[model samples]
Target: MADPIPETADTALVPTLLGDVIPRVESAYVLGLPSPQILDLVLERSRSTTVLVATDEEASQLKDELPDAVELVTAGIAAFAQDRRSQPRELVLALGGLDGLLPPADTMPWQQRLAHVTALAQAGGTVIVGLGNDAPLMALGHAERIDWARADDDPTRPTSAAALAQALAAAGQPVTTVHGLYGDPVNPGAAVIDALATGSRDGSLPAQVVEHVIDQAGTASIPAPDVVAVAARSGQLSNLATQWVAVSGGRGRSVYWTVDDAVVWADQDGPGLDWVIGGDADTAAALPQRVPDTITVERTLLRHIARADLPAFRAVARQLGDWVRSSADAAESSEIRLDEVRVAGATLARGISLRHAPVTDAAPVAEDAPDVEREPDPSARQVSASEARLAQAWRRFATRFAHSGRRSAWPAIFGEEDLVQLWLTMSGVAPGTVAPEADAPAVAVPAVVDEASRLDILQDRVAALTDTLAARDEQLLIREARIRTLRQQALGAARNRDRAVKLAQDLRRSRTYRLANQMRRASLVAQPKTLVRGVARKLDGKVRALRRTR
Candidate 1:
């Protein structure tokens, strides 16, 4: 076993993540090598006493961190269960699961080890077991192939969440609920109870929320969102989760998921389920006091897309457009996202309000100004704040929509930019009114690539490249025309200079020129001052010519 490590910020939040499932009790016993932070949370939440059972290595590090008031037992599962001093407790937390508590020397079966742990909990008491799924979708392409010939591997261990639940039931503690833990198994960022996970209908609001939770927990190796969508529709998402937190004789919240750094959980005690945020004051304050009901505009649209129902999609699109136009504040309308807008019967209202830092506009530059090299400013635009915000929101939605892989009313040939223009028009915003700057940075969507979406993305890329090439071609044509005009002007000036030189030569050669020269000499002779000035000018010109020769 590795040395016990100190609790991290994420691990510290594990207690909060599992807080609903872990019941408050008078006395609690935590078995195995759980995180020190979890132990601390248990200690703090327990009313009277808390006991920790860990190996010698883990205990060495934990002893310094834990107080003397808590009893620390150092023994294997076999020895600990055989001890007569061991008594039933109100809460038994085996968060490390059976593998962590089992010693290599001990030959106890997995089922028996589970039974021993449950026996420590009193009747009607709560037992929370954290078990890793045998196979998770996130581990699909990354994990190494297992060798069937390995003799040391435990054969009797529970292979799936269902098997583990059954094992717990057989151990005299029937599971009350099984929460699907997402993200890291040690400290899951989100959890959904079995009731919600199994009961939510595919393409419904609750199902979409669960799908989003899995998407957040997914890694780069797997296209979690797309896989989760398909799996949720097929009713297999519960089995594909990374870890399962099974609870016996205790009730927990229906759902819990993290947004940004804050945790949001759905309260089941209320007449209708309502979400409450728990985190830092600032984060909590920024989020809505209550989350919208399950049926959201985004979910309804997605359902329509899945069925290829163009009329239904158009109806919802029209409603969204109408809502955007009717909003008293255009700035507020810009912040409203399809997912955040809830749908109840025929009524629609904005639900969650995500706090985005206000974007300050820079001083707009004149269009006819001379070209100069400078850094591009995103906020330097002629568009109003409302138009800019609307454009930005529309662009974001377009990018996400293209990558979503759902069937849209538009043709397959339509790219991301085309969809943006279409959607903008549909939302009562003119396509040409708010022109996106050519140099504006593209909005980045989640890196979830699947075969279904690959074609759409490639098509969009090709269309974008085509448009870019066309613009560049037009620019090149304008530059060529300008260059041609300059060349003609230079030629005309050269011809004019040649004609003036010839005329001067012809005039100097004519008899009239000699007469004019003599007249000029006569005039100079008549005025002495003029003659002196003329002589001086001639001398200066001669001197300048001499210097040039030198």
Candidate 2:
């Protein structure tokens, strides 16, 4: 670890060391036909040597029941990768199954292939994986066999080694012409070249080869991902790794490839967490250790920036006069309201707002982004008569992009509008807008109407109880009145028996007295409290009866 202290400041020139990088091509596959068919086609088209690595189990099977005209090498992928150091390869094209070069099948998860690549990815080697169609291979996780729909969804999404080889070139990787590193492109190649055509300063493709050569680089053509900012806020880019660099840029913006030089800078970092790399000429050698006080990248300070991290890019413009601190432009999207902040689905209004928004800077967050909720664009607002109509039916537009659950569906029905109030209410987003007028949707909330809510059942029970209580009271009162009348008539009649002169009058009067007496008795007996007490007394009187019934 030596600083660049000008080795020699001669009359006019000073010498400097240029970095080195190696080219690597990785192909993602779909597992089945893509492995057996498309892979070979690409190899043949690219004019590279294709070797098949096979394990004992697969070799036994393939040797007996070979398919078509598939030519394969029978070593395990690990063994072959190790042997590359001994025999070496200019371009190692490894195919599938018995065709793989690695041997000893007890290891290697097929997908990661971690064991072999570790040793084989040196300056002398360039690795290329051939996948015919890995759809079935990847699909094996969900089902016993392959799923056609899911497998074929995107035929070319997997790594294409041919494309990768081109990407490495575009990335300014270390190796030169296929022959320069592997020594001779294909036949009778030497393990190392003791010959001519020195490579780039970094020992990549020879200056002659990469000087202006821009062919076959696919990822190189795409637009580079920009540094999107969220002010003080941040999130993890789940789509990529922790140490991410813009994969495509310059002539091959779309093309993504890794250079050995990039890895060197990343590994040399002395725990420079979230520090950015590559800022002006100063960042070239900025290792992390020197800036123990602040989170920093080597000289550049660009390497430390997190994918989702957003510290005000040039908040104070910490520079000397004419110098600007950051080169990244701010991401222009509007911010989520401080009140609407949500974390793990708890309405974090008062309790967690302080956590999300530290007082230092006002930055937006990118983690757990759902589609954005729309607010009136502050620029457009004038009170009008439509206020009434709008209140009655304010239609806030919502598309699939407005929520987190459905990022994939954004392409279809984009920019569509639905009632903002209804959508917010349905999804339970904070600060839900309500219907404009008092009468609007005043019946019941949608959640109440849902059959699963059990409102209907509760309402039925309430109605049944009301009817039973009302009817029972009425019936008991009538019974008491009838019994009283009968009792009064009997009493009057009995008294009149002594005198036959006014038979009907005495009978009537006696009946009235009997009825009144009966009515009083009936009232006492019919009382629910008295009936319950009598039942309890009877039970007490006949304990044996209760035991027998039991």
Candidate 3:
């Protein structure tokens, strides 16, 4: 089809850097589905104790149709983290076929399933692998033994993902335009699949750019591909998120992740429900609600001037200059005019003066970086001269061009354990041992038998089997029964383990609370009222003396 856009990680990691700006994605939904275990874990671990599971028709349909249970569980987690803004907990995805009835995978290949799961975990859900897997089948593109797996597309689902878009638009928040398949080659299928959409030849993302991005993501196996690289709207980059995830990998080049809207614009630290509505250092007196606490705008004043009238620009620039506390620049301040344009989310106005300086691109973390477990001086990485200049130009054209920063931060997401675990799950021996072009083995021909010879052979076999048939059938029944009993025992043990884990969590919480109470009681004492009374009398005497001296 359309040369199935390139599905490489590089293609996915191409962050839209317009004037040193990036995009963010926002999602809101009920999370943790179809499992009391997951709900319990989330409740036990998260800041919010109230856990919700959407027992709707859609979840059921998704479970039945989805090939991977891990995907479904991950989907639940992503929905909670993004839309629900719920604290994350581990959701174990029971291995495919190991469970009673594996979900039917009607379409989409195994590769897509694996990547989507990676995306979910990256978005902030804890995914874990469940037991009972076909290890050999995993080698042949079958997935089992998945851990910390979640799908990205479910959060950015096709029909249900318009809330963030509309909210942002209404609040005048920047938006990153994205499309399906062609949008992110490396992450072909994403959660925020708003629709089965298409891009135009004259769109912002040209066909060439799409090809470049896709190639960066990874190559798709298509025969006789005719690829055209030109400035045609290949598609918008929606559903920003981490493209590459692994439970295990030999130290190698960084992998890419598709961008998600909620994550794309997450604040430098991350999104949190508690954001100060006004009086924040973002330089905006009052930002619209669509802007989450975790996100930061490069220059709201520059963006406003670029999008509005010149007269309006004067007022906005005046306030911005005041906020920057630049007492040195405004004395010789002058208005700006646009010469050229760069567009991603906002239409920026450009001019050469003290008003705008080149924005800085955040320096890259050392390749094979591990995690952001600690806080640091929100440092922007060392950058190049050309990149700084480009960022300035993008800022000038703030209206048409918007930058989504989501793609810039994939590596920090979907930690090492999840990635290695998933890779282990989806990898092994290739599909079948029988080669595609292999021929059947030859067999020796049986000696020909006449009708009488056949009759004699059948009669002899029947006479011999008459006595043994019952015994043979009984033996077969016994074997079947024994195997069933063994299987039942194994399953029972697993269930028991699960129950034990649940009990352990409950006990842990209770003991923790109890210990905290004991410590507080022992470490603290009530103030003595008699001592307080003496201190008050002494204070009164001292005050009376001071008054008399005055």
Candidate 4:
């Protein structure tokens, strides 16, 4: 098979930059190419295989550009979201056609479309969104912005890179500008080689100038990722939600979840330690004795363990325990810490007591994090009707609860007993009910149902039932006998009818009957009654004479 990733023009710079920062951020937006040229760049430079998601029109534009070896899925936002069966290593969302200027009738809102695309990013997959300058990128997420300034592509016009940087800075946003170099048309190989060697060749000078312009703009500031300010710890596990926020704390790092649910690897500059539960071969033996062999990570917008399995929860806690210990070991050296894990309403755990500072009052959570729960912002676009109904339901429920004069702000102020009771309720168990221990010896309790010992009575009832059935069977036999008698009578009638029909046919063919019919016809031939009578008498005499001769 042909190589999946074609080493084309020196498009490596953009892909290389994406490869470096995409793993670090929640999502990354490349604000340069109007097409999916950046996708090819990323694929050619990065070792990880990637796939492209595009609309029908976009896919049409991309026909024959990339080799058939690469997988491209053509689907709209909603269809793609519903049909995402597996996560690719990397995802490139071609959003050039989703220009902001287009009416909603023609195209979906770029913001919502972008949200869905970024939300599909796998735990380890890097999602690179390619869009034009008309669609703004800052409102999306903690997406690292890069300006690809193409040289000679449009030297006379203000390049998209320069214009985008100015727009972002005007909106008080930060952007990283990179010079995009293209190879010479005649000597493409030499030009690509030279540009790769020194960021730019002769044809790429315009891009270099655009980068300089962005630097001179003096408005854009490259700052660290901002940590969102969330409120204090909430009530019970049932009420409290796990939050995924874009913060300045963890850079060049992402918490990659393994496919086997074995570990959630936090890759960064730190001591190498695997936070593993059941799936890790080395630490499998060291796990808690009663840990489950497999774990189920909840499929929701929020990152949490949302299963009723206690053993799986313990296994998850063991992994989190490793993360906590690792965080504690490097607390002084590093800024990142694995704080309290917010369990789903279903996980069976109280709270983790950490030596370091307690988990931060989670900030107003960002809605862009994939594989985590995100509450929609009020200012954002309206969701589908079903989602709107759900939101309204929650609003109504919360409003009623608050108005009911109860002092409980469930999640924000849950007592230990309250949390336990809520967990029990969610688990379909009544409050104060003790769960039976499997290994414990069984004890005889007073029976609510009265015990009846009457084997003789049961025998008598069975005998009566048998007699009734036998009587029914006798009735059935009588019915069958009646049916047989009716059938015999019908057969006899059919035989008599057949014989009568045969006798009638034989009589009609007889010579005497034929002669009688001829005599009747000869009588009818006469005009008057007297003449007819005379002819009849003559015919009768002639018939008698003919009979005697025969």
Per-model clash counts, in order, read 0, 78, 97, 10
On a 0 to 100 scale, what is the lDDT of residue 529 in model 1? 99
lDDT of 4 by residue, 1-550 (tens): 2211111222322333233444333223221223344565545554443343344565566566756655555545555555653542343333232332222245454444545554555444443322222111221232332323221232322223444334333323333322222222111111111112122111111222222222232222431011110101111111011111111111222222121223212222222222222323543332221211111121110123222344543454344333333433223212221222222333311111112233332224446745746685555553333222222222333343344343432333333334433433333333334222223223223234233524544665687689889999999999999999999999999999999999999999999899999997776666478777887899999999999998
The TM-score of candidate 4 is 0.22
TM-score of each: 0.66, 0.23, 0.20, 0.22
Candidate 1 lDDT over residue span 1-550, tens digit each: 2212111224534566557666678888888766656776787778655554546787787778777788777887766777823578888888766766756566677777788888888889989887766555555565451222111356667656677788899889999888777665545656777556655554444455555655554553656556666666676767665667788977766666565656655555442455554454665565555654456676677778777676787677666666555644333443666656766455555555333353343435678877768786665556555555545655666667777765665555455766666666665666466654554433233355566677876786688689889999999999999999999999999999999999999999999999999998898889999999988999999999999998
Error of 1 at 421 (Å): 2.1
Model 1: residue 542 alpha-carbon error in angstroms: 99
Clashes of 1: 0
Worst 10 residues of 4 by lDDT: 223-232
What C-alpha lDDT does candidate 2 achieve relative to the native structure? 0.29
After best superposition, candidate 2 residue 256: deviation in angstroms? 10
Q: 174-234, model 2: which lDDT tens digit per residue?
A: 3232211111111101111111212111111121111111111111121111111110012
lDDT of 4 at 519: 92
**Where does candidate 2 stray beyond 4 Å?**
1-34, 56-70, 81-87, 93-125, 128-235, 238-550
Q: Listing every candidate in turn, what is its Cα RMSD in Å to the true structure after a full C-alpha superposition?
A: 29.8, 27.0, 38.6, 27.7
Question: lDDT of each structure?
Answer: 0.65, 0.29, 0.30, 0.34
